[model samples]
Target: MTNITKENFDKAKNFYNFDTLYAPVLPGLKATVMKHQDAITDAFYKELANDEIAAKIVAGRVDQLKATHKVWMEELFNGEYGEAYFNRRYKIGETHVKAKIAPYFVEVITSSLRRSFAQILVAEGAVAVQAALAILDLDAMIIIGAYHEDRMHRMSDVTGMNLNLLETLMSFG
Candidate 1:
Protein backbone atom coordinates (compact mmCIF):
# COMPACT_ATOMS: atom_id res chain seq x y z
CA MET A 1 0.00 0.00 0.00
CA THR A 2 1.34 3.44 -0.90
CA ASN A 3 1.75 5.66 2.13
CA ILE A 4 0.15 8.62 0.31
CA THR A 5 2.48 11.18 1.76
CA LYS A 6 1.87 14.90 1.37
CA GLU A 7 4.50 15.10 -1.37
CA ASN A 8 2.83 12.51 -3.59
CA PHE A 9 -0.60 13.92 -2.89
CA ASP A 10 0.58 17.37 -3.93
CA LYS A 11 2.22 15.90 -7.02
CA ALA A 12 -0.98 14.14 -8.04
CA LYS A 13 -3.12 17.17 -7.29
CA ASN A 14 -0.85 19.36 -9.34
CA PHE A 15 -0.63 16.81 -12.15
CA TYR A 16 -4.39 16.61 -12.28
CA ASN A 17 -4.73 20.37 -11.89
CA PHE A 18 -7.15 19.54 -9.17
CA ASP A 19 -6.79 22.84 -7.35
CA THR A 20 -7.66 24.90 -10.39
CA LEU A 21 -10.11 22.60 -12.14
CA TYR A 22 -11.85 20.76 -9.31
CA ALA A 23 -11.60 22.99 -6.25
CA PRO A 24 -13.81 25.72 -7.64
CA VAL A 25 -16.87 23.59 -8.31
CA LEU A 26 -16.44 21.25 -5.36
CA PRO A 27 -18.40 23.42 -2.95
CA GLY A 28 -21.38 23.74 -5.23
CA LEU A 29 -21.26 20.11 -6.25
CA LYS A 30 -21.31 18.68 -2.73
CA ALA A 31 -25.03 19.05 -2.16
CA THR A 32 -25.74 17.72 -5.62
CA VAL A 33 -23.50 14.71 -5.02
CA MET A 34 -25.13 13.95 -1.68
CA LYS A 35 -28.59 14.28 -3.14
CA HIS A 36 -27.87 11.58 -5.70
CA GLN A 37 -25.80 9.19 -3.58
CA ASP A 38 -28.37 6.46 -3.19
CA ALA A 39 -29.28 6.38 -6.85
CA ILE A 40 -25.62 6.22 -7.81
CA THR A 41 -24.78 3.50 -5.30
CA ASP A 42 -27.84 1.44 -6.23
CA ALA A 43 -27.04 1.69 -9.91
CA PHE A 44 -23.45 0.66 -9.27
CA TYR A 45 -24.51 -2.42 -7.38
CA LYS A 46 -27.22 -3.21 -9.87
CA GLU A 47 -24.65 -3.31 -12.63
CA LEU A 48 -22.39 -5.43 -10.47
CA ALA A 49 -25.24 -7.84 -9.85
CA ASN A 50 -25.73 -8.24 -13.56
CA ASP A 51 -22.11 -9.11 -14.28
CA GLU A 52 -21.36 -12.73 -13.42
CA ILE A 53 -17.81 -12.06 -12.29
CA ALA A 54 -18.65 -8.93 -10.30
CA ALA A 55 -21.73 -10.55 -8.83
CA LYS A 56 -19.61 -13.36 -7.46
CA ILE A 57 -17.13 -10.89 -6.00
CA VAL A 58 -19.95 -9.00 -4.29
CA ALA A 59 -22.08 -11.99 -3.38
CA GLY A 60 -23.30 -12.00 0.23
CA ARG A 61 -21.73 -8.56 0.70
CA VAL A 62 -24.44 -6.23 -0.53
CA ASP A 63 -25.04 -4.40 2.72
CA GLN A 64 -21.37 -3.94 3.45
CA LEU A 65 -20.78 -2.70 -0.05
CA LYS A 66 -23.59 -0.19 0.18
CA ALA A 67 -22.51 1.12 3.55
CA THR A 68 -18.86 1.46 2.62
CA HIS A 69 -19.68 2.97 -0.76
CA LYS A 70 -21.94 5.50 0.88
CA VAL A 71 -19.16 6.54 3.21
CA TRP A 72 -16.76 6.78 0.31
CA MET A 73 -19.13 9.03 -1.57
CA GLU A 74 -19.53 11.25 1.43
CA GLU A 75 -15.82 11.58 1.84
CA LEU A 76 -15.46 12.35 -1.81
CA PHE A 77 -17.72 15.37 -1.58
CA ASN A 78 -16.57 16.52 1.81
CA GLY A 79 -14.24 19.15 0.22
CA GLU A 80 -11.16 17.85 1.97
CA TYR A 81 -8.92 16.48 -0.72
CA GLY A 82 -5.96 15.82 1.49
CA GLU A 83 -3.75 12.97 2.56
CA ALA A 84 -6.52 11.01 4.25
CA TYR A 85 -8.69 11.19 1.18
CA PHE A 86 -5.96 9.94 -1.13
CA ASN A 87 -5.01 7.28 1.39
CA ARG A 88 -8.50 5.84 1.46
CA ARG A 89 -8.78 5.98 -2.31
CA TYR A 90 -5.44 4.26 -2.73
CA LYS A 91 -6.44 1.58 -0.27
CA ILE A 92 -9.61 0.95 -2.26
CA GLY A 93 -7.51 0.36 -5.38
CA GLU A 94 -5.19 -1.95 -3.48
CA THR A 95 -8.14 -3.87 -2.08
CA HIS A 96 -9.63 -4.41 -5.51
CA VAL A 97 -6.34 -5.69 -6.92
CA LYS A 98 -5.62 -7.88 -3.90
CA ALA A 99 -9.07 -9.39 -4.16
CA LYS A 100 -8.29 -10.24 -7.78
CA ILE A 101 -11.24 -8.24 -9.11
CA ALA A 102 -10.82 -7.40 -12.76
CA PRO A 103 -9.88 -3.81 -13.60
CA TYR A 104 -12.66 -3.64 -16.19
CA PHE A 105 -15.25 -4.18 -13.51
CA VAL A 106 -13.80 -1.26 -11.55
CA GLU A 107 -13.96 0.88 -14.68
CA VAL A 108 -17.59 -0.11 -15.08
CA ILE A 109 -18.32 0.99 -11.53
CA THR A 110 -16.63 4.35 -12.06
CA SER A 111 -18.47 4.86 -15.33
CA SER A 112 -21.73 4.18 -13.57
CA LEU A 113 -20.83 6.73 -10.93
CA ARG A 114 -19.90 9.35 -13.54
CA ARG A 115 -23.09 8.74 -15.51
CA SER A 116 -25.30 8.92 -12.43
CA PHE A 117 -23.79 12.19 -11.22
CA ALA A 118 -23.84 13.75 -14.67
CA GLN A 119 -27.53 13.00 -15.05
CA ILE A 120 -28.33 14.53 -11.68
CA LEU A 121 -26.22 17.62 -12.28
CA VAL A 122 -27.64 18.18 -15.75
CA ALA A 123 -31.21 17.70 -14.61
CA GLU A 124 -30.93 20.22 -11.77
CA GLY A 125 -29.24 22.80 -14.01
CA ALA A 126 -26.80 23.35 -11.15
CA VAL A 127 -23.51 22.61 -12.87
CA ALA A 128 -22.18 23.21 -16.31
CA VAL A 129 -21.20 20.24 -18.42
CA GLN A 130 -17.55 21.26 -18.43
CA ALA A 131 -17.39 21.51 -14.65
CA ALA A 132 -19.11 18.18 -14.28
CA LEU A 133 -16.57 16.59 -16.54
CA ALA A 134 -13.70 18.08 -14.55
CA ILE A 135 -15.13 16.60 -11.39
CA LEU A 136 -15.53 13.19 -12.98
CA ASP A 137 -12.07 13.38 -14.45
CA LEU A 138 -10.60 14.12 -11.05
CA ASP A 139 -12.43 11.14 -9.61
CA ALA A 140 -11.21 8.89 -12.39
CA MET A 141 -7.63 10.09 -11.96
CA ILE A 142 -7.60 9.24 -8.29
CA ILE A 143 -9.04 5.79 -8.88
CA ILE A 144 -6.68 5.07 -11.74
CA GLY A 145 -3.72 6.33 -9.70
CA ALA A 146 -4.58 3.87 -6.97
CA TYR A 147 -4.68 0.98 -9.41
CA HIS A 148 -1.40 2.01 -10.98
CA GLU A 149 0.29 2.39 -7.61
CA ASP A 150 -0.81 -1.10 -6.57
CA ARG A 151 0.35 -2.66 -9.82
CA MET A 152 3.72 -0.96 -9.47
CA HIS A 153 4.12 -2.42 -6.01
CA ARG A 154 3.27 -5.87 -7.25
CA MET A 155 5.70 -5.51 -10.11
CA SER A 156 8.42 -4.41 -7.71
CA ASP A 157 7.90 -7.58 -5.69
CA VAL A 158 8.13 -9.80 -8.73
CA THR A 159 11.27 -8.03 -9.93
CA GLY A 160 12.86 -8.49 -6.52
CA MET A 161 12.18 -12.22 -6.63
CA ASN A 162 13.61 -12.54 -10.14
CA LEU A 163 16.77 -10.65 -9.16
CA ASN A 164 17.20 -12.88 -6.10
CA LEU A 165 16.87 -15.99 -8.25
CA LEU A 166 19.46 -14.67 -10.72
CA GLU A 167 21.86 -13.94 -7.87
CA THR A 168 21.41 -17.52 -6.52
CA LEU A 169 22.11 -19.02 -9.96
CA MET A 170 25.23 -16.86 -10.34
CA SER A 171 26.44 -18.08 -6.95
CA PHE A 172 26.05 -21.71 -8.17
CA GLY A 173 28.24 -20.87 -11.21
Candidate 2:
Protein backbone atom coordinates (compact mmCIF):
# COMPACT_ATOMS: atom_id res chain seq x y z
CA MET A 1 0.00 0.00 0.00
CA THR A 2 1.17 3.56 -0.66
CA ASN A 3 1.46 5.85 2.30
CA ILE A 4 -0.10 9.27 1.93
CA THR A 5 1.44 12.08 3.92
CA LYS A 6 -0.88 14.75 5.29
CA GLU A 7 0.63 17.38 3.03
CA ASN A 8 0.20 15.23 -0.03
CA PHE A 9 -3.34 14.28 0.93
CA ASP A 10 -4.18 17.94 1.53
CA LYS A 11 -2.83 18.90 -1.89
CA ALA A 12 -4.84 16.12 -3.55
CA LYS A 13 -7.98 17.02 -1.62
CA ASN A 14 -7.65 20.68 -2.49
CA PHE A 15 -7.54 19.82 -6.16
CA TYR A 16 -11.30 19.07 -6.14
CA ASN A 17 -12.53 21.78 -3.78
CA PHE A 18 -13.00 24.40 -6.55
CA ASP A 19 -13.14 27.02 -3.79
CA THR A 20 -9.47 26.69 -3.04
CA LEU A 21 -6.54 28.40 -4.74
CA TYR A 22 -7.50 26.34 -7.73
CA ALA A 23 -11.01 27.79 -7.82
CA PRO A 24 -10.53 30.36 -10.54
CA VAL A 25 -8.89 27.75 -12.68
CA LEU A 26 -12.11 25.73 -12.97
CA PRO A 27 -13.78 28.08 -15.43
CA GLY A 28 -11.08 27.19 -17.85
CA LEU A 29 -12.08 23.61 -17.25
CA LYS A 30 -15.64 24.43 -18.21
CA ALA A 31 -14.43 26.21 -21.29
CA THR A 32 -12.39 23.22 -22.30
CA VAL A 33 -15.36 20.89 -21.88
CA MET A 34 -17.65 23.12 -23.90
CA LYS A 35 -15.13 23.88 -26.60
CA HIS A 36 -14.33 20.31 -27.49
CA GLN A 37 -17.45 18.34 -26.64
CA ASP A 38 -18.57 17.14 -30.07
CA ALA A 39 -15.13 16.63 -31.53
CA ILE A 40 -14.13 14.66 -28.47
CA THR A 41 -17.23 12.49 -28.57
CA ASP A 42 -16.89 11.87 -32.28
CA ALA A 43 -13.27 10.89 -31.88
CA PHE A 44 -14.18 8.68 -28.94
CA TYR A 45 -16.82 6.75 -30.90
CA LYS A 46 -14.52 6.35 -33.86
CA GLU A 47 -11.81 4.93 -31.63
CA LEU A 48 -14.38 2.76 -29.90
CA ALA A 49 -15.87 1.49 -33.15
CA ASN A 50 -12.45 0.53 -34.41
CA ASP A 51 -11.85 -1.66 -31.41
CA GLU A 52 -13.18 -5.18 -31.96
CA ILE A 53 -14.64 -5.40 -28.47
CA ALA A 54 -16.57 -2.13 -28.69
CA ALA A 55 -17.62 -2.59 -32.34
CA LYS A 56 -19.17 -6.00 -31.57
CA ILE A 57 -20.86 -4.73 -28.43
CA VAL A 58 -22.22 -1.50 -29.89
CA ALA A 59 -22.68 -2.47 -33.54
CA GLY A 60 -26.33 -1.76 -34.24
CA ARG A 61 -27.14 1.00 -31.77
CA VAL A 62 -24.60 3.73 -32.46
CA ASP A 63 -27.25 6.41 -32.66
CA GLN A 64 -28.98 5.44 -29.42
CA LEU A 65 -25.64 4.96 -27.81
CA LYS A 66 -24.54 8.42 -28.95
CA ALA A 67 -27.85 9.88 -27.76
CA THR A 68 -27.47 8.71 -24.18
CA HIS A 69 -23.82 9.65 -24.44
CA LYS A 70 -24.69 13.23 -25.39
CA VAL A 71 -26.68 13.59 -22.18
CA TRP A 72 -23.67 12.48 -20.16
CA MET A 73 -21.39 14.89 -22.03
CA GLU A 74 -23.76 17.83 -21.61
CA GLU A 75 -23.55 17.56 -17.85
CA LEU A 76 -19.89 18.52 -17.87
CA PHE A 77 -20.70 21.93 -19.28
CA ASN A 78 -23.81 22.49 -17.14
CA GLY A 79 -21.62 24.39 -14.62
CA GLU A 80 -22.66 22.48 -11.54
CA TYR A 81 -20.40 20.06 -9.70
CA GLY A 82 -21.94 19.14 -6.41
CA GLU A 83 -23.73 16.05 -5.08
CA ALA A 84 -26.38 16.18 -7.79
CA TYR A 85 -23.72 16.12 -10.48
CA PHE A 86 -22.34 12.81 -9.23
CA ASN A 87 -25.76 11.21 -8.93
CA ARG A 88 -26.46 12.10 -12.54
CA ARG A 89 -23.22 10.44 -13.63
CA TYR A 90 -24.11 7.23 -11.86
CA LYS A 91 -27.53 7.37 -13.46
CA ILE A 92 -25.91 7.63 -16.89
CA GLY A 93 -23.98 4.47 -16.13
CA GLU A 94 -27.17 2.70 -15.19
CA THR A 95 -28.78 3.94 -18.37
CA HIS A 96 -25.93 2.46 -20.39
CA VAL A 97 -26.53 -0.95 -18.85
CA LYS A 98 -30.23 -0.67 -19.63
CA ALA A 99 -29.27 0.09 -23.23
CA LYS A 100 -27.07 -3.02 -23.28
CA ILE A 101 -23.81 -1.12 -23.70
CA ALA A 102 -20.74 -2.32 -21.91
CA PRO A 103 -19.15 -0.25 -19.14
CA TYR A 104 -15.69 -0.53 -20.66
CA PHE A 105 -16.77 1.94 -23.29
CA VAL A 106 -16.83 4.58 -20.57
CA GLU A 107 -13.10 4.22 -20.14
CA VAL A 108 -12.70 4.42 -23.86
CA ILE A 109 -14.68 7.63 -23.90
CA THR A 110 -12.94 9.21 -20.93
CA SER A 111 -9.42 8.39 -22.10
CA SER A 112 -10.16 9.74 -25.54
CA LEU A 113 -11.49 13.01 -24.11
CA ARG A 114 -8.55 13.30 -21.78
CA ARG A 115 -6.17 13.05 -24.68
CA SER A 116 -8.09 15.63 -26.64
CA PHE A 117 -8.37 17.87 -23.58
CA ALA A 118 -4.66 17.60 -22.97
CA GLN A 119 -3.81 18.78 -26.44
CA ILE A 120 -6.25 21.66 -26.14
CA LEU A 121 -4.97 22.63 -22.72
CA VAL A 122 -1.41 22.79 -23.92
CA ALA A 123 -2.46 25.49 -26.32
CA GLU A 124 -4.68 27.27 -23.77
CA GLY A 125 -2.08 29.52 -22.10
CA ALA A 126 -1.66 29.50 -18.31
CA VAL A 127 -5.19 28.40 -17.33
CA ALA A 128 -4.94 24.91 -18.75
CA VAL A 129 -3.30 23.15 -15.84
CA GLN A 130 -6.21 23.41 -13.45
CA ALA A 131 -8.61 22.66 -16.27
CA ALA A 132 -6.69 19.53 -17.07
CA LEU A 133 -6.79 18.36 -13.47
CA ALA A 134 -10.53 18.91 -13.23
CA ILE A 135 -11.06 17.00 -16.45
CA LEU A 136 -8.98 14.11 -15.16
CA ASP A 137 -10.90 13.89 -11.90
CA LEU A 138 -14.39 14.15 -13.40
CA ASP A 139 -13.66 11.72 -16.23
CA ALA A 140 -12.33 9.17 -13.74
CA MET A 141 -15.65 9.12 -11.91
CA ILE A 142 -17.80 8.63 -15.01
CA ILE A 143 -15.53 5.96 -16.41
CA ILE A 144 -15.43 4.01 -13.17
CA GLY A 145 -19.17 4.31 -12.69
CA ALA A 146 -19.71 2.90 -16.16
CA TYR A 147 -17.22 0.16 -15.46
CA HIS A 148 -19.17 -0.77 -12.32
CA GLU A 149 -22.39 -0.98 -14.27
CA ASP A 150 -20.71 -3.14 -16.89
CA ARG A 151 -19.52 -5.51 -14.19
CA MET A 152 -23.01 -5.69 -12.71
CA HIS A 153 -24.56 -6.51 -16.06
CA ARG A 154 -21.94 -9.12 -16.79
CA MET A 155 -22.42 -10.77 -13.44
CA SER A 156 -26.14 -10.81 -13.96
CA ASP A 157 -25.81 -12.34 -17.39
CA VAL A 158 -23.46 -15.06 -16.25
CA THR A 159 -24.75 -15.89 -12.78
CA GLY A 160 -28.32 -14.69 -13.01
CA MET A 161 -27.65 -11.94 -10.52
CA ASN A 162 -30.90 -10.11 -9.83
CA LEU A 163 -31.87 -6.53 -10.61
CA ASN A 164 -31.38 -5.84 -6.94
CA LEU A 165 -27.80 -6.94 -7.25
CA LEU A 166 -27.24 -4.57 -10.13
CA GLU A 167 -28.80 -1.65 -8.26
CA THR A 168 -26.94 -2.52 -5.07
CA LEU A 169 -23.61 -2.64 -6.84
CA MET A 170 -24.34 0.58 -8.68
CA SER A 171 -25.16 2.29 -5.41
CA PHE A 172 -22.03 1.00 -3.74
CA GLY A 173 -19.73 2.49 -6.39
Candidate 3:
Protein backbone atom coordinates (compact mmCIF):
# COMPACT_ATOMS: atom_id res chain seq x y z
CA MET A 1 0.00 0.00 0.00
CA THR A 2 2.98 2.32 0.52
CA ASN A 3 4.95 1.73 -2.65
CA ILE A 4 4.64 5.23 -4.09
CA THR A 5 5.80 7.33 -1.16
CA LYS A 6 7.59 10.66 -1.22
CA GLU A 7 10.62 8.99 0.24
CA ASN A 8 10.78 6.57 -2.63
CA PHE A 9 10.33 9.37 -5.09
CA ASP A 10 13.16 11.31 -3.52
CA LYS A 11 15.36 8.26 -3.61
CA ALA A 12 14.60 7.75 -7.27
CA LYS A 13 15.43 11.38 -7.98
CA ASN A 14 18.74 11.12 -6.25
CA PHE A 15 19.53 7.96 -8.10
CA TYR A 16 18.90 9.71 -11.42
CA ASN A 17 20.72 12.98 -10.63
CA PHE A 18 17.48 14.85 -11.10
CA ASP A 19 18.91 18.10 -9.73
CA THR A 20 21.60 18.31 -12.34
CA LEU A 21 23.04 21.51 -13.74
CA TYR A 22 22.32 19.84 -17.05
CA ALA A 23 18.65 20.64 -16.46
CA PRO A 24 19.01 23.73 -18.61
CA VAL A 25 18.84 21.44 -21.60
CA LEU A 26 15.22 20.69 -20.81
CA PRO A 27 14.00 23.43 -23.09
CA GLY A 28 15.97 22.00 -25.96
CA LEU A 29 14.45 18.61 -25.27
CA LYS A 30 10.98 20.07 -25.11
CA ALA A 31 11.44 21.93 -28.36
CA THR A 32 12.81 18.94 -30.19
CA VAL A 33 10.08 16.63 -28.95
CA MET A 34 7.32 19.07 -29.72
CA LYS A 35 8.70 19.74 -33.13
CA HIS A 36 9.16 16.12 -34.03
CA GLN A 37 6.25 14.59 -32.16
CA ASP A 38 4.31 13.34 -35.12
CA ALA A 39 7.22 11.47 -36.62
CA ILE A 40 8.31 10.21 -33.25
CA THR A 41 4.91 8.83 -32.41
CA ASP A 42 4.41 7.41 -35.85
CA ALA A 43 7.55 5.37 -35.42
CA PHE A 44 6.62 4.48 -31.86
CA TYR A 45 3.18 3.24 -32.77
CA LYS A 46 4.56 1.40 -35.75
CA GLU A 47 6.83 -0.52 -33.40
CA LEU A 48 3.95 -1.22 -31.07
CA ALA A 49 1.72 -2.35 -33.88
CA ASN A 50 4.36 -4.87 -34.85
CA ASP A 51 3.66 -6.72 -31.64
CA GLU A 52 0.45 -8.75 -31.65
CA ILE A 53 -0.40 -8.45 -27.97
CA ALA A 54 0.41 -4.76 -27.72
CA ALA A 55 -1.54 -4.04 -30.88
CA LYS A 56 -4.54 -5.91 -29.57
CA ILE A 57 -4.40 -4.16 -26.26
CA VAL A 58 -4.40 -0.84 -28.00
CA ALA A 59 -6.61 -1.88 -30.88
CA GLY A 60 -9.38 0.63 -30.33
CA ARG A 61 -7.33 3.23 -28.51
CA VAL A 62 -4.55 4.27 -30.89
CA ASP A 63 -5.59 7.89 -31.09
CA GLN A 64 -6.28 8.07 -27.36
CA LEU A 65 -2.96 6.43 -26.59
CA LYS A 66 -1.14 8.72 -28.98
CA ALA A 67 -2.56 11.78 -27.24
CA THR A 68 -1.57 10.46 -23.84
CA HIS A 69 1.87 9.56 -25.11
CA LYS A 70 2.43 13.12 -26.29
CA VAL A 71 1.42 14.44 -22.91
CA TRP A 72 3.78 12.01 -21.21
CA MET A 73 6.64 13.06 -23.47
CA GLU A 74 5.96 16.72 -22.81
CA GLU A 75 5.97 16.16 -19.08
CA LEU A 76 9.30 14.38 -19.38
CA PHE A 77 11.10 17.61 -20.23
CA ASN A 78 9.14 20.04 -18.09
CA GLY A 79 11.90 20.19 -15.42
CA GLU A 80 9.35 19.94 -12.63
CA TYR A 81 10.49 16.86 -10.82
CA GLY A 82 8.42 17.07 -7.68
CA GLU A 83 6.44 14.63 -5.58
CA ALA A 84 3.37 15.42 -7.61
CA TYR A 85 5.30 14.60 -10.75
CA PHE A 86 6.31 11.34 -9.21
CA ASN A 87 2.73 10.65 -8.29
CA ARG A 88 1.64 11.19 -11.87
CA ARG A 89 4.34 8.96 -13.29
CA TYR A 90 3.67 6.29 -10.71
CA LYS A 91 -0.03 6.45 -11.45
CA ILE A 92 0.87 5.66 -15.04
CA GLY A 93 2.58 2.50 -13.89
CA GLU A 94 -0.43 1.53 -11.83
CA THR A 95 -2.60 2.11 -14.85
CA HIS A 96 -0.42 -0.08 -17.01
CA VAL A 97 -0.77 -2.89 -14.52
CA LYS A 98 -4.53 -2.55 -14.47
CA ALA A 99 -4.57 -2.52 -18.25
CA LYS A 100 -2.68 -5.80 -18.25
CA ILE A 101 0.34 -4.27 -19.93
CA ALA A 102 3.16 -6.73 -19.85
CA PRO A 103 6.61 -5.71 -18.69
CA TYR A 104 7.90 -6.65 -22.12
CA PHE A 105 5.61 -4.09 -23.67
CA VAL A 106 6.68 -1.56 -21.09
CA GLU A 107 10.31 -2.18 -22.00
CA VAL A 108 9.47 -2.07 -25.67
CA ILE A 109 7.74 1.29 -25.41
CA THR A 110 10.42 2.83 -23.25
CA SER A 111 13.14 1.60 -25.56
CA SER A 112 11.27 3.00 -28.49
CA LEU A 113 10.93 6.36 -26.74
CA ARG A 114 14.57 6.51 -25.76
CA ARG A 115 15.72 5.70 -29.24
CA SER A 116 13.34 8.22 -30.75
CA PHE A 117 14.46 10.96 -28.39
CA ALA A 118 18.10 10.17 -28.83
CA GLN A 119 17.91 10.08 -32.59
CA ILE A 120 15.92 13.28 -32.72
CA LEU A 121 18.36 15.02 -30.44
CA VAL A 122 21.29 13.89 -32.50
CA ALA A 123 19.61 15.05 -35.65
CA GLU A 124 18.67 18.37 -34.08
CA GLY A 125 22.26 19.19 -33.06
CA ALA A 126 22.48 17.13 -29.90
CA VAL A 127 21.35 19.45 -27.13
CA ALA A 128 21.67 18.46 -23.48
CA VAL A 129 22.22 14.81 -24.13
CA GLN A 130 23.15 13.93 -20.58
CA ALA A 131 20.34 15.93 -19.08
CA ALA A 132 17.83 14.54 -21.52
CA LEU A 133 18.85 10.96 -20.91
CA ALA A 134 18.95 11.52 -17.16
CA ILE A 135 15.41 12.84 -17.04
CA LEU A 136 14.23 10.02 -19.26
CA ASP A 137 15.89 7.52 -16.96
CA LEU A 138 14.27 9.13 -13.95
CA ASP A 139 10.85 8.96 -15.55
CA ALA A 140 11.34 5.34 -16.47
CA MET A 141 12.58 4.54 -12.98
CA ILE A 142 9.51 5.96 -11.30
CA ILE A 143 7.11 4.27 -13.69
CA ILE A 144 8.76 0.88 -13.58
CA GLY A 145 9.30 1.15 -9.84
CA ALA A 146 5.62 1.70 -9.17
CA TYR A 147 4.66 -1.03 -11.61
CA HIS A 148 6.91 -3.53 -9.83
CA GLU A 149 5.75 -2.54 -6.35
CA ASP A 150 2.13 -2.85 -7.33
CA ARG A 151 2.74 -6.25 -8.86
CA MET A 152 4.56 -7.30 -5.72
CA HIS A 153 1.67 -6.24 -3.52
CA ARG A 154 -0.81 -8.18 -5.61
CA MET A 155 1.39 -11.24 -5.58
CA SER A 156 1.94 -11.00 -1.86
CA ASP A 157 -1.79 -10.87 -1.23
CA VAL A 158 -2.61 -13.75 -3.50
CA THR A 159 0.12 -15.94 -2.04
CA GLY A 160 -0.45 -14.92 1.57
CA MET A 161 3.20 -13.95 1.86
CA ASN A 162 4.66 -10.79 3.26
CA LEU A 163 6.41 -8.58 0.70
CA ASN A 164 9.73 -9.21 2.33
CA LEU A 165 9.25 -12.95 2.05
CA LEU A 166 8.13 -12.66 -1.55
CA GLU A 167 11.13 -10.50 -2.35
CA THR A 168 13.42 -13.01 -0.63
CA LEU A 169 12.02 -15.84 -2.65
CA MET A 170 12.36 -13.81 -5.83
CA SER A 171 16.06 -13.36 -5.11
CA PHE A 172 16.73 -17.06 -5.22
CA GLY A 173 18.49 -18.60 -8.21
lDDT comparison, 1 vs 2, better candidate = 1
What ranking emerges by lDDT with the best candidate at the front?
Answer: 3, 1, 2
Highest TM-score scorer: 3
Candidate 1's C-alpha lDDT? 0.70
**What lDDT score belongs to each candidate, Candidate 1 first?**
0.70, 0.61, 0.76
Q: Model 2: runs farther than 4 Å from truth?
A: 1-15, 19-24, 28-35, 97-103, 142-173
Residue runs of model 1 more than 4 Å from their true location after superposition: 1-12, 123-132, 161-173
CA lDDT, candidate 2, residue 108? 61
TM-score of each: 0.76, 0.61, 0.84
Clashes of each: 0, 0, 0
